[model samples]
Target: MIKRALVILAPGFEEIEAVVPIDLLRRAKIEVVVAGILPGVITGSRKIRIIPDYDLGDVLEEHFDCIILPGGAEGAENLKKDIRIKELLERQILKGGWVAAICAAPGCLINFGLFLSNKFTCHPSIKAEIPLSRLEENSSVVVDGNLITGRAAGSAIEFSFEIIRQLVGEEAVKEVNRSFLSNLPMLGSIRKE
Candidate 1:
């Protein structure tokens, strides 16, 4: 069976973090539902607008293999304030489904009391907000049990592959990576940051 994923998109969500996973998951043949937290078009932190596949209310009763949260400071705050997001996340967790968050979105997991003792990573700016004991600073992505967290926007691709690996398998990840030519390095000469 194809894996199904629900990616929650709130206004001010990080565009890359949201899009990369959705795109890659689709490429891997996972059914991705991009749901807006509100009724209409949602704008990203950089002002990119996207129409969601469904509104959060429309999918409240739907089942998914994973629930994904993309982070922006404002977006994460919006998610944190939504009782419905909390409820959905808790329900998914109770059913032993995967819960994934990136960057500041991990704050939502933290706020919802879902972080528990799970090791996770998030944007450096939000590190102080997460308990030091639970932070895994060395990796771009951290997966503990059914919980998956990514460090920042730059790590979105790697984070997404990890999600695919967990839901599908390493073989699926290799196939997707090959299709994207992700195994190949940059075409041009490397430039130092």
Candidate 2:
């Protein structure tokens, strides 16, 4: 079956973090649903506006293989404040689905009181807001069980590759990177090797 992903786009989401994963996952044949937290056109931190394929409420009852979160400082904060986002996160996990967050977006997970484990990474800028013991400081992308987290916008591609790997397979990742000509493919980390 084709994997499905719900990408929650808040008012100030990071454009690259949101788009790269959406692009690469679609290239890998995953069904991606770009959903806005609110209705109509949603604006990013850099003022890029997007018309989401669906609104968050429309898909609350739908089952997705994964839920993706993209971060901007304001975007993360916006996501954190939404009770619906929290509901989706909890429901996704309860139903054995995955959740991915990048940059400050992980702050939403942390702030919402979900994924209380000590194995995630977010942009260092938000470190002060998170407990130090839970921070995976060195990795650009950290995958802890069903939760996938990435450090920042620069790590969005890496973060996405990991998600694709989790949903599809390593071969799909290789094909995706090869297709994208990604210098940072979905193989074992260059930093770790």
Best candidate according to TM-score: 2
**3-91: candidate 2 lDDT, tens digit per residue:** 89999999999999999999999999999999998999999999999999999999999989999999999999999889999989998
lDDT of all predictions:
0.88, 0.89
Candidate 1 per-residue C-alpha lDDT over 1-193 given as tens digits, one digit per residue, 9 for 90 to 100: 8899999999899999999999999998999999998989999999999999999999999999999999998899999988999999989999999999999999898888885888888999889878988888767888888888999998888888888988998888888878697753322111112
| Residue 102 error, candidate 2, Å | 0.5
Candidate 1: worst-modelled 10 consecutive residues by lDDT? 184-193
CA deviation > 4 Å runs, candidate 2: 189-193
* Model 2 clashing residue pairs (backbone): none
Residue ranges of candidate 1 with Cα displaced over 4 Å: 184-193
Clash list (residue pairs), candidate 1: none
Cα-based RMSD of candidate 1: 5.5
